[model samples]
Target chain A: MALDIPSPAALQLTASPAAVSAALTTTQVRVTSSFRGARIVLYGAVFDPSTTPSDVVVIVRGPDLPVRIARKTKVAGVWVNSRPVVFRGAPGFYMTASTRPLADIAGFGTLRRLGAGIDHLAINAPLEQHTETRYGVRDVVVSRLGADYLDWRRAVVRLKENAGLYDADDKGVTFVDKDLFKAEIDLPTEAPTGRYQAEIILFQDGQPVSRKVRSLTVEKAGIERTLYLFAHRSPWLYGLVSMALALGAGWAASLAFRRN
Target chain B: MDLYLPIAEVSVNAPLLVALGALVGFISGLFGIGGGFLMTPVLVLMGIPPAVAVASMANHVAASSTSSVISYTRKRAVDFRMGGVLAAGGVAGAIVGVEVFRWLRLMGQADLVVALSYLVFLGVIGGLMLVESLQSILRRRSGQPPKPRKDRRPPWLYSLPLKMRFPRSRLYISVIPPVLLGVFVGVLSAVMGVGGGFVLVPAMVYILRMPAGVVVGTSLFQIIITTSLTGVLQAGRNQTVDIVLATLLLVGGVLGAQLGAKASSRFRAEELRALLALIVLLVGLRMGLGLFFTPDEPFILMTGMG
Candidate 1:
């Protein structure tokens, strides 16, 4: 029920993905909005429509968090009290809530909640779920015909695929698969004549799985390159253009207002 | 005063900006556009890097728009058909802004062009705003309601072709002026690093004679569209948009605008214009001074980096 509500505090972002795993149906979700105000620190998370609020693990972890929040107990072979303990913050503590209690291998396996009876929760046998995360550009291959050699405007780049496991589909469907993922970098004609590098990363369950690196080269053209260097090297020319632009823009603005 | 923002580290210093959203909201609550002239320069001085400031301002304006547009819809201050026509022309002009920025950057002359435009255009705008507000103030002091520009076609604009019929402004204007205003703002945005609100808001209030009711909302709609694109592009290109930064500014701006909207009605139209005029003049002065006396340092040579 809470999933439908948009959390203003959530760091929401939207990205254009051209692949099955890349296209996020609901890219913007309430990550969480917990901030300490005056006294109490607010901790919250949205309940997926299918799951009850009690069943979800709303973990709070950082420095000085409680190790245990709840414990399961059985009396007369009839389960009664699910242990709930709130610990006072000491120093560096982190808190995590999980519906799956360890002692059994799979934690809170695949949940197929049936209308109003019971959600079929089995042992975690690789819970069929996937999340698409963004990794920085790892490596880039740039071809520039050396400064004062090749035309600066004609720089081209072929970004080869940086392989990573990405979510295929999660429309409440069975069995999610891996999808091809990559980044497309766009360059403006004004890129500086130099070398630049970027890094790429892969993540699973809020953890880094892999990483890579890449680079690019920016070179200048002939005639203009010489002219550009000459103009910039000579301080006078730079000042000249700066003043000229200031005067021109001033003139244009005046014209806009003066027309009336 | 806790004015320093956390993520951007850019303290919002303008007293007028701190009060503007509240002021505008107040008037928009009462009469309208009482203090619009102040919005642009105030945002600039706050160190929002121009583009995002305008976009954020626009988005904030949308909230105000949400409020007033409802009333304007009731009062019919907004001639729906006319606004649509202007918006259509404006979109065509807006495309030019992106190109102009790219072109200027290609020449490694973006800052130069931007600074120059600010000097030239803002001078005229600031001068006009000051003079007009002063005159209006005098007229009101002399016990006159200062009959608004009842019906006069600004000669130069009226002279152009592609005439348009705007019922609310009650004039048959040339499509050229509005479209040109749109393009001019678009190009200005690239150089100015604005979402075009600084240019367009004044154009609407002073040039087009839009009832104050429609100006903020109409301008905001455009700002939202432009800025949202800008947000995506900035994310794609620079990857410098720290969501934390944007959120901090948004948080401050949203709260500020709410207060500005409430402060609107306490001041008269002339008073608002006077404050606006003062803001523009201050920005103009700052730019003018920088022009004559730029810092004594070997300015880093900006080699073209697309």
Candidate 2:
């Protein structure tokens, strides 16, 4: 589905300088049993069309979750997991779309400050303080593993990327007219269920002038929701019910076979 | 028909799951086993998370064994007195197993432990079964009867305290051995997600010296209790039980088991044992190869625990 901001709204916004607003085609994604994937369009308007052209950056981040990353090493000629590190508040889903390459749009410092790209994404651990001085991009995440911390951080991004949970597009945003702009993001089947924030930023002169945040939710629906809730909210009851269903099914099958 | 499983949090082909369940069920019914040993590995291969595969298959095994126990009871082949003692020990073992499973998961070693257990148990059991069955088959071909297994209880077994008489099996022995056997099988069922039939059957025959006729029946009866408890514990503790997945599997399993039981009458017992042993060995070999092979991805990610 294509999202379109009304032209009248853009015209009204044009009266006020440096104003931007965006909305997703659908704010709530219902993940039923048959759900495969979904494509959502983020459309918005730029207020000052007559002014110098500005770049648009869109970032969609899913709910933060605690994750553990484990690396395997060969031991006794067999591959086994050796060291595991846990990172808290890591986004389960993260995607970035921009009018131009993030590096070309702004300097590394500015991009890092804005958190505009995958490399600049913030991932933190709770223990062992350390500073990353790689290529003059100083970011600090606490870790006791010394230099291995960077490897773990990169591993998170690499693993998430392989799972289709992290993505970035250099030229994902496009302008349809002088003031109308849109970006399309594909939410894969592996997307986690939670609230996702879509941030739309208008960058002018290599600086973010105005930003708007739109949020969407991905949630289980129908039988999927019922079962998920049943399993989590009341696990003991769910277990009993599971046993009852299995026993009943077994008893019925036995009776049927016996009668024949 | 791809369907999303809520608990496993993955989409799997519905028909594929049913067919897998049917295949395991057929084998179980033919052999009078629980089939969990076969089912869990296949599910893991299908990309269902290992923990979910183990727990949900326990549920499936419980159902399948329940059906088999009924027929065994009707045949008057079950030793309820022994089964009860074994089940008591099994319950205790299952409780401990679940805790260990959770601990292993937290340490990110549960999958490795599961695979290694399968390889070791399947390799030893399958190899032994194959050798014994092949020898019997060879003996029958030469127009000779199979050698009678020594049914004498060990000297140490007689001196143990808390002895009890099992009238059905016609044995008076210490309850310690049976309880210990039950605990070992119970731990196996919880950790490896098996009905523990393959292991239990051999131990009963060789160690407990149970009659061959009652061995299968009593094993099924014990499995029904142990696995049901394991399923409940896994669901309550780990929240890994997928009802939808289990139901689909049960539907195909119940139907397949009935057909397999009917077909079992046509095959020679020795031939069946040889076939089952080969299948078990093959599964073990595959599991072992996984440990040796270099994985495409050496890094793993787990969520929910910090």
Query: Which tens-of-lDDT digit does each residue in B104-203 have in candidate 2?
Result: 9898888788879878989999999999999999999999978976766788888999999999998899999999999999999999999999999889
* Model 1 lDDT tens row, A35-67: 111111112222122321122121111122121
Report residue B155 deviation for candidate 2 (angstroms).
Answer: 2.8
lDDT string for model 2 (A1-260, tens) is 11221222232222236868888999999888988778999999988645776889898988877778888888998888865677765688888998898888877887776666878766766654676766766785436767777888888899999888899998899988878999998988789888888888787777666778888999999999999999999998999899888878877888999899
Write the residue-wise lDDT of candidate 1 on B166-239 in tens digits. 76656687776666676565455434545555567688877876776667656644543444343333333322
> lDDT value for candidate 2?
0.86
| Residue A67 Cα positional deviation in candidate 1, in Å, after optimal superposition | 48
Return the lDDT, model 2, position B16: 85
Which consecutive 10 residues in model 2 chain A have the weakest lDDT in total?
A: A1-10
What DockQ does each prediction reach against the true complex? 0.01, 0.61
**How well does each candidate superpose onto the true structure, as a TM-score?**
0.45, 0.92
For the predicted complex of model 2, DockQ is 0.61
Candidate 1: list runs displaced more than 4 Å.
Answer: A1-260, B1-76, B144-150, B154-164, B195-198, B205-217, B225-242, B301-306
